[model samples]
Target chain A: MCRMCDWLGEGQIWYKNPKLHANRMYKLREPGRKPQESLRGNIVGSNLHEALEAKANGDLATFNRLIAEKNAADARKVGAQPIPLNEAIEVIKTLQMPVAAMMCICRKATRAEEETNLNEYSCLALGTGMFKWERWPERYRGGVEFLKPQDACDWLEYWDKRGMMHLIMEEGNDFLGGICNCDYPDCNPIRQRVDYGLDQQLVKGEYICEVDFKRCNGCGECLGRCHFNALKFEVTIDRPSIDPMVCFGCALCQTACNRGAINLVPRSAYPALRNVW
Target chain B: MNVVINPKITVDYERCTTPFDCKRCIRICPPAVFVVYDIESHRGYEVDKKQPGTYKMLPLYRDKCTGCMKCVEVCPVDALTVKMPEEMLT
Candidate 1:
């Protein structure tokens, strides 16, 4: 289990808990207190040029200090954890708040691609935040499409079939906000973690995928689905091997497997991986 | 220790008036280092991208830049400039 589970799970995985989603729907503002800025807004305002410059100049101390400072400040803000498709649907089914399918901001920012059509929206916005998304025009451009729980599940399945990893995002401390269906360098959080070694922004899931060699064939269908490079085809054995440590438990490879050779087991089952997150 | 150098990217907002309409820098950069965003949107309201100067290009992830110069070459107005440190030439 991850630290989020320890803090907000209330004896269950944090994302799986319905109460967290319910509480985040409408946070009552304290009387006479100013409203805080959103995490995405804060991220946009932050200047990472100095840290990147230090990194370029081979100044490890300065780079580490700057990154650490930024991470510490963002520790209480938005963060995400990869969740399997079924669990993601389960979260949607259980939540009472509105679920809206919105254009992926990461895709727009990283690739300059726009999902103008309703069917093309790849990100799901949870809770009441979707109601007032017009406030953040840059982030919520092209508007949003509200979905029924059943439709949301089907939409999640569609993205799963398309080989996108499902990640549940926390808006504030212990407040569940959205579900992101994205992959690789195109996804901001994934890119930050994989390319820049910024792990705090996203954590591994509650499960780890394992390969069932008995039913396996070297079809190589599942190899390309892995964004983390955790799955490697063993040429000698003619089977795919999974590096348990590298797997985020998104189950994209598992879904892609035609032979049903891949299975996800609880991370707690392995003592070494129990606290890896 | 081996010395490393990175490209310093700058976009002259004056030379580049309409960034939303012309996204050459955003599209050409292989690393997707450049982002075109609305300046007024930060103030908590939507701004029309059709209005010139409302949107601007920013090199948000300069660390990821490989000094490819693709963005600079692709810029129609020649507003982008990528300069490497002089130490790298020594």
Candidate 2:
């Protein structure tokens, strides 16, 4: 955030002459004219079938963790270094890579097409905790002066040793490998309209992050943190009204769960709004 | 030059937030005046060119106008209120 603030402080938000009354040029291209960006899918350069089978058979457990382990291992074998996440973020912005959630593994996430049935799993990490990673001390040690191009590769190298830095998917694909991780929400090939608040999800959410009703301790830590006006006391079925449109999927609610009641499951982004994709 | 929408002047709309980085407000204005940007929205105030050349005033005033509301019919979101030394409303 500090670095982003610095970038913002430099008066650079793609939009020129942001001040009111200033006549500036419009750079937003039409949808078709917009650059070609593929959505991410569960397509890594690894054996996804076995991984999924293990998950289905209760051997691997959550698909997210398995995908991370595999990607980390492969990244290490190929000598991919951890580019300072902050620097990597900067590079993604500079180079304009098409990614979602900064940490999207290339092939595990993508856009939902109007046609074609896909067994693919597209998940974005939406990890707010990683902001702490961006502020990690070691990343800024080199300073931009020494943040050379080679250092970019070294950054990926460092990344290979860690856990899945972004959203990971364990599945199949046709083009663009099974791993698309990095940044650039619009073009990251790993994100979709829903990842960056572009889908029909602008309406109120239905399936909100919830806790096991049985495990409710009645603590209200999550109430203040919730940006949306959802969340209710546990008494009847009125637990929390999840307005998905407002939920950025930051998972702070789950983090605050003292009784392990908050669990994120597939729920309607909004009830009234029809799914466009 | 600055595009002044005097609080007394007429503007098309209070403002328009065209989403993402839509500089529609800038494109519509005649003067190459700078619009201020809000800290979060990244849209708003610009230079008060009527005075000494420097950044001043509500730096984030632009984000306030969403280019919607009825006010836009008269005051365009691109409208600016330039305060000349003499015309400066005390």
Candidate 3:
């Protein structure tokens, strides 16, 4: 287990703890309470937008200042944790709550750019959030459907096949709220953290991917699967090289590799990346 | 709470076809202002069954719209009419 599983994991590897996420729907489902975003998700999205705008305007001073303030502010907000898709499914099975797939507003805003019948139902809202979702009519517009845990797993696996990484989010850092299956540029959190140089809300996964070069073929398939720009093709080795500091340990590369050459080691195992995140 | 901007987009339900097939407007709006609305039920695609006025595009995020008009340009049915916020025109 990595430091996250050690610190937040609370001896149960965080995601494995039922009590850490027990009756989330019960607590969040009070009548007429506003559907709210976790402070971190809200702040990071807006901060990244502003910072990017600043950079676009060639205002490096403003961009640097904004990023610094946002970073400090992020440390104080509630956490928006990033768990690998495989572990996220395990968390879903443990929670055993009703799951509903929702349209991804981030992708709708960023990548899809408009609306298309792309059939990309990439966001998963869990627990009471799914029930009281109508409280936020604007967000629940595309609609949501309940899924059996098994079906949810299958759906996520399908997205995985399509190269999406999953991250579980806690609304306001209290209630277990969503499972966002996302890719680069389209995902608000990933885009902010990766492109904006403002790393606050989203944390890296507990593990980092390591490549065993002996069995590896230099096919370069895993390079595109990485959203974090962690994977690179080493010209000398002619194989994929992973920069552990930049890796999120989502293991999309491992799954993408047909040769079984990649593996995830606990991030804590490396002194450099252990405290980097 | 989510914020909405000033946008007035109307769709010619009679001409536009999303329930049975086409969804160009829904696919093209950047702010996701357009959602599939069931006129007969006054609800959205949240329901399982498709109704008679099963799929007409409605402006759900009219406030979030930046008046890009990409949807207006992309709609094949020529069913969408968009009004920009007055301030945007200025």
Query: Which candidate comes out best when scored by DockQ?
Result: 1
lDDT of 1 by residue, A1-277 (tens): 6777766676688787765444445564445544433444345334356776688767878887877766765555556889999899998888767899988888876666668767899999888777887776467766789999899999999999998999998776546778999998789789877866667778888899999999988789998899898999999898999999999899998889888889999999998999876
> Taking the tens digit of each residue's C-alpha lDDT, what string does model 3 give over B17-52?
553245566666665555553445433324332334
DockQ each: 0.39, 0.01, 0.07
Instruction: Put down candidate 3 lDDT per residue, A26-83, tens digits, no spaces.
Output: 4644455454434443444446446544554457687788889888877766445666
Q: What is the lDDT of residue A262 in candidate 1?
A: 94
Which ranges in model 3 have alpha carbons more than 4 Å from their true place? Answer: A1-8, A23-49, A113-119, B1-90
Judge candidate 2 at residue A139 and give its lDDT. Answer: 18
DockQ computed for model 3 against the true two-chain complex using alpha carbons = 0.07
lDDT of 2 at A145: 19
Q: After superposition, how far is residue A77 of candidate 3 from its true place, in Å?
A: 2.8
**Regions more than 4 Å wrong, model 2:** A1-208, A232-241, A244-246, A268-277, B1-90
Candidate 3, position A37, lDDT: 36
The lDDT of each candidate is 0.79, 0.31, 0.69
CAPRI quality level assigned to candidate 2 from its DockQ score: incorrect
How far in Å is the alpha carbon of A60 misplaced in model 2? Answer: 53
Clashes of each: 0, 76, 13
Which stretches of model 1 miss by more than 4 angstroms? Answer: A26-47, A75-78, A134-138, B1-3, B42-45, B84-90
> Which candidate tops TM-score?
1
